[model samples]
Target: MNEFRHVTVLLRETVSALRPRPGGHYLDGTAGGGGHTGLLLEKIQHTGRIEALDRDPDAIAALKKRFAGEPAVTVTQGNFFQAARLFPHPGFHGILLDLGVSSHQLDTPERGFSFHTSAPLDMRMEQDGPTARDLVNTLDEPSLRRILRDYAQEKYAPQIARAMVAQRSAAPIETTTQLADLIAAAVPAAYRREGHPARKTFMALRYACNGELDGLEEALLSLFNLLQPEGRLAVITFNSLEDAAMKRAARQLTAGCTCPPEFPVCVCGKSPRAHSLKPVFPSPEEIERNPRARSAKLRVLERR
Candidate 1:
């Protein structure tokens, strides 16, 4: 296996904003390699505690080794969106979610998230979940088009989805290389090589396979009662879709009413749940070292 060299993006800024207290409880929702969790635990050495969660088994195993015999830590294997159910704690002082695919997953050919390398069309963050191949091969043209258009915002979604449906009839699209070639053929030759044509299709498929955006809203709602008063919930999102969801959730949680703007008097009984701290971005220095951090956006909420 290749060495896991994930340089946790937005490391300094994320940990610094956390401002962890010695006796407080914290959680790292996506503990890839334990990079951020390691720092959080170090801050909590004598009095605080850390609960680390990861969907990837390998990451769980690696983190277990990295934090072994540390009474200050607890490691769990599963989606962080399901955290409230998994953790025994009624509330926590701090929570950090780094929502991005790890460098190890992308660089490993067998996992198939990158166009630079040819591999199986498997993009499961969890090893056992349904993969890109299954979605591409089984969904109807209209369904595929909706996924591409809605999730990836691909302008040529209809044409690409049509072509995919027609091609897969001959045989199942089994490999990432084959799928990439098919998407290239679907796009106009004049537009070819401007960027990988398969990029959007792959992203849409992965999002659908993982049901990423589907459960996000509810997860945020669940976390509202799970954070202690004055506790912080920090989320780091990689794309606009995820960022938008987080933004809307925070707004809803913090705002006093969902009533129409024309309303002169308060009717809706919804009170403010949390306050939105301004969203933070990666520093140019951090982006220079890791270009993948370029699009990352971090939004934090403080329970009221």
Candidate 2:
């Protein structure tokens, strides 16, 4: 827990953009360690309610412990996509989506979220799900290649996928070290020296196994619908794919008149639901303290 308490990226900016008020209802979609939730609960005052959601059981437990005896807070152990079903509502005043693997996940070797750590190759946000090993062991070469190419944006995905298929025939790819080593060996020498050779491959496998990107897309739409008129939504993304999705979704939702150009009468009648808030980022001081914050990007939207 101490490790996770270090620093959350764009913490102040994100919270400020949320602008929670007394008695306002709020949701923390990725309540990892309750760091941001704790702050929100404090700012929202005792009357305000917060329905915090996390898919990981351990994270939920941690949050419950951290925020014990606080009736204003309802800790839920489930994906945020279920927010609409989890609670009956006209919609919340504010919603926060911190979309990235938490520091706890990266620090814990058993979680297998980091290339520096040699664990079981499991990267599911849920404690129990089809792990990286399961995908590597069972996925055919073509599926593996597509996952790497599409999810991780790896250029040598096909070659790496082919290599993985060949290597697994000799032995089961059981551990993080095994897969990392194989990926490192498969990539070109120039790329190998630039960064962890397994970073892209691991990220791709984790996304595929957890269905993270697709889940994010669904969650974003659900969240938009769950905001009260003039309510606010904030999302923090750690990767290009996630950031791009957020950018596009924000643009589409905030855009007015979605009717086709030929439809001069505006038959589609799609009015803008939300307006974009200035995207947030870490201060130089915060980034210096936590290098991981360097990649984080925060986007905010206000329901119209």
Candidate 3:
């Protein structure tokens, strides 16, 4: 197996924001490489317990090994969105979700998350389910176009989708390099010079293949509901789509009366369930050390 070395983005900021305490019950929903989990474990010492979950089998294995013989940590192989089913009770002191692709997923060529390397077009975090290859090879042009535009905000989505359809007509686009080359050929030369032409396209494909955005709002609501009073939910999103979704969810959670200005009292009787803190960003030093951290944004919300 490839060495799993994921530099946890906003490590200190996330832990400090959660304010873990002794005997506190916390959850690391995305236990990639166990970076944040390790920090949480340290802060809580041996008094608190953490339930760490990861969809990736490799990450689950790593976590199990890393926390072996440690009574304070419990590792599970599952998705964060399905966490409610795992733990029916609603009394978590804190929950941390470091969203988006992990460094290990991108760095490992076989995962097919990065356009920098040539590998089979398989971007499944769980290593099961439909893959990037299936989407690129089987999806119709319109569906592909929608995923590119909606997920990645790829401006030239139509052209890229057209190029994918045209290229795949003769042969299957089976590798990351193959799809990247096709995207480079489809876009204008000036656009190609801006960045890796395949970056956005690959991102879109990965999101679609993994159903990254499906039921996301519901999941966020579920997570918030599971939190005890004053319990915190800290999320680290790597893209604008996730950031915007989080903002909208936070607003909904913190929203008060919906009654009109003329109304003397709120007939709707909707009270704020949670409060949001200012979103946090990575430091310049962090960005310099890990360029991938440049786009990361951390948002924390506390249940009322």
Candidate 4:
């Protein structure tokens, strides 16, 4: 198995934001490589407990190996969106969800997460779903265009989708480089010069394959509900789509009564449940050390 080498983004910042203390029970909703969870374990010591979950089988194996024989740690294989059901006992002291692709997934060519590789177009986080090859080869142009536009916010989504369908009709687009080269050719040369032509397309496929943004806001709210009063739900997002959903969830939690100014008496019993702190970004030094961490943003919402 390839080494699960994932640099935990915003490590100190996220743990500090969560404020894990001895005897506090916390949750690492996405325990990829167990970086953040390992550090949090140190802070909490033997007194505290941590419930770690991940959809990736490799991640689950790594976490189990890393935390084995440690009674305080429990590693489970599942999606963070279903945290409430999976972790029936709520009232967690803190919950963290780091929504970024693991470095191992991208670096390992077989994962097909990066367009730079020449592997099969298979970017399944859980490793059991329709791959990028299946989507590009089978989906219609309009659906393909929608995935690109909605998931990655690709500006040339229509052109890319049209080209993808046209090329696949002749023969199935099979590999990472095949699709990457096709995208490079489809977009204008000027756009290609700006950056990788396939980056957005690849990201869109990963998102679609994993259902990353679907029911995302509701999931965020559910995770927040799992936290006890004053417990923090710290999430780290890599792109605008996820950040927007996180912001919306935080806004929903922080929103108070909806009664109008004209109403003299209190009507809506709804009050603020949580408040978000200032978003955290990677430091210049950290970014220089690991360029992949550049786009990460950490947002912490405290339950009231």
Candidate achieving the largest lDDT:
4
CA RMSD, predictions in order: 1.9, 1.9, 0.9, 0.9
In candidate 3, position 165 carries an lDDT of: 96
- On the 0 to 100 scale, the lDDT of residue 144 in model 3 is 94
Residues 8-90, model 2: lDDT tens digits:
67877787788978899999989888877878878888678988899977787788887899988999998887878887674
- Which 10 residues in a row give candidate 1 its minimum summed lDDT? 39-48
Candidates' C-alpha lDDT: 0.84, 0.84, 0.92, 0.92
The residue ranges of model 2 lying beyond 4 angstroms of the native Cα positions read 1-6, 259-268
Off by over 4 Å in 3: none
The clash tally of candidate 1 reads 0
Model 2 poorest 10 in a row by lDDT: 1-10
lDDT of 3 by residue, 18-75 (tens): 9999999999999989999999999998677899999999999889888999999999
Give residue 155's error in model 4 in angstroms. 1.2
- TM-scores, in order shown? 0.94, 0.94, 0.98, 0.98
